[model samples]
Target chain A: MIKLKEALVIAEAALKMARIRQLNPMSVAVLDARGCLVAFQMEDGSSLLREDIAKAKGLSALALGMGTRALVGRAKHHPAFFVGLSALSKGNMIPVPGGVLIRSPLDAAIVGAVGVSGDLPDHDEACAIAGIEATTYSWDAGADPS
Target chain B: MIKLKEALVIAEAALKMARIRQLNPMSVAVLDARGCLVAFQMEDGSSLLREDIAKAKGLSALALGMGTRALVGRAKHHPAFFVGLSALSKGNMIPVPGGVLIRSPLDAAIVGAVGVSGDLPDHDEACAIAGIEATTYSWDAGADPS
Candidate 1:
């Protein structure tokens, strides 16, 4: 499992990079293996809903054991099951981009995930990837380094 | 309902106590009466499971109209029904200690609940109780304190 301090630093770095890149102010959340939040932060100008969106995205990634972007494809193919998942998690599971699974650098084990929100879907995803890369962990994109 | 700022302060204090006492790192959650998260934090070394455990416990307390510890006795007598609730809430119902409802100090209306995990069950409960006491909100034991 990733340390909480590491998780927070990873999340903060993601937000800072978003600012430097001129992306919309964003909120980020990191969740541990069991879908528990490790750390979370919302930039001052982010939307009120950013926190919930970030958390749900991260929870979906953790619970499903894949990046949430992958779930988006699956969700489109199996809309009914996807909708069912939302109800099953009491409205906490969000199948969308911007949630990326983090793998250990040494052994490639699943450590946790990071979720970003408050920008376009692609932009949000970029921020999440950037955040994971800032840490020792790597983003699990099923083979894509970027 | 408890405001978001109050909820954050309560969760932080609970976590600070966990650190000062040299207990296991803990994750804490505060939810509104409608079961939406208001604020959350996890200590530096808490496990990944702590996040889910804390949120489920808080949601259980909010939905059941009592503390999670009280629900434990009921769960024992109605194991089947209790298990069914997990399906009903999409696995968000955890009938365990460390989930406590918060009531408004003046009107005694339900405000929210706090959930803590990453320590002994009784110790987790103590941290949760300490958090609520730190706030203006009072712990609701299903009685009229007003």
Candidate 2:
């Protein structure tokens, strides 16, 4: 199924892209519904802090149903409410970019998501999209990295 | 002009670039000095756990004038304090890669920050570098990513 292994593929692709573009380095990860690490990948020279980013963003993508970046705007309109969410999420709720929902394009059903950084917010989001886009496996049927 | 927006763009570019190159995906967050939302991004399928990685890493990066990733290394060697910090931050003070200070090139100052995830400690650091390079952004003069 579309489990942790799929997360690994996304990470591998992200890291490779980072190097080719010479955009510093990178760190990546995948998580399950409970926000636990399922699949993870980190480029050389990336820092340990990145691990947290990957986990947090990945979770955000799934929880928010929107990219982490989108949350920033919504949080602004409702400061108090956003803060409450931040607390409720145990500091895991981030309204930032670099995170997107992973779903079955065919049916548009939510499946998983990816989070990225090591670049700018937009850059992180872009990479995340790319990571999810190039997957040859089928989330509906569960598959391995292609 | 290239303040928060610049930072976000740089981070996103780095993430996408990294992913395309088969590197690691990353989680990145950008914030203003007052901890306002500047920009944010997360890769796709990043799992649902790392939702708040950006906020935690941003705090560390802004708090210190170095790199959050560095703190993770330190934490490994000194779990006692990290434990306390973790409790103090309530899981918001995540010390990991892809987290760094943002500053002005004209004058080294703690203006903003960027956090990343998805790779190993070293790799996260590299991705942070890519973000900085691609965007005319730099770490806070004395800010630490941790």
Candidate 3:
């Protein structure tokens, strides 16, 4: 289970890495297994939109059972369906990089997802990966979902 | 100026107050001034709906710049307009008794909002109020707006 405290630590770690790398101000969001917000942090200089984007990205990762980076190709192929999903989720389906699924390192069971925003897409994704690594949890990049 | 750590404290306090009162499982949400979620927590037994309700309540309070309880009377009077607002917000408007605006105690400037759900309306409101009181910020029950 992705405890709330663990989620908070992951998000904080992600933002810290962002700062350490001198990336633009960033926001991080963590969602529970049920796709509900657990904890979130917005750096003081981050734009307000970063908060929503991070949340949407995390929710999308949870709903699709894949990382946001992987969703990009699928979304591009099924643009209409993806747009419909955004409407259904009330604009929460953000199919972009920076969202990654978090799993228990021991068993590989999904725990939750973490999303980072407010920097270049790849940089945001890197921060999310770093955050997941900081925790005992492992990240599922959706490479081989067997 | 409400940081994520403070927001988490408020939400956790609201849930704790609910437990102390022996109320039903509850979910609490805190949103920053820009109307983005700062923290959220759902009790172990809370229904899934509680999460959505708590967030909608906080978002409504932020969008209207008043407590949800205060919005109830106005919503009753202008039912059509209020309904329209729900659509505009993609169903985030929840004019109920459990949402309260948070203001800086010293300056009373709007800082954020807290929302609680999954118990009796009055009980939820009480929990929200208690949580706000537990913090340094003041609760805006929509009195003395000036």
Best by lDDT: 3
Compared with the true structure, what per-residue lDDT tens digits does model 1 show for residues B51-85? 78998889888887888888777777889998899
lDDT of 3 by residue, A1-146 (tens): 57766876787789778988999988888888887776677776566688789988888888888888888877888899998999998998887789899998788788899888999988998889888888889997554212
Q: CA shift at A95, candidate 2, in angstroms?
A: 1.4
> What lDDT does each candidate get?
0.79, 0.62, 0.82
Residue runs of model 1 more than 4 Å from their true location after superposition: A10-27, A33-36, A41-56, A59-97, A100-111, A126-146, B44-48, B76-87, B141-146
Model 3 DockQ vs. reference: 0.40
Clash count per candidate: 1, 111, 0
Which CAPRI category fits model 2? incorrect
Q: For model 1, name the residue pairs that clash.
A: A88-B90
- Please list the residue runs of candidate 2 whose C-alpha ends up more than 4 Å from where it truly belongs after superposition: A136-146, B1-140, B143-146
Best-fitting candidate, scored by DockQ: 3
lDDT of 1 by residue, A110-140 (tens): 9888888888877888888888877778897
lDDT (Cα, 0-100) at A127 in candidate 2: 69
What DockQ does candidate 1 score?
0.25
- What is model 2's C-alpha RMSD? 18.2
Please state how well chain A of candidate 3 matches the true chain A, as a TM-score: 0.92
Give TM-scores of chain A for all candidates.
0.90, 0.81, 0.92
- Alpha carbon deviation, residue B45, candidate 1 (Å): 4.9
lDDT (Cα, tens digit) per residue for candidate 3, span B97-141: 898999998888899888889888779989888888888899975
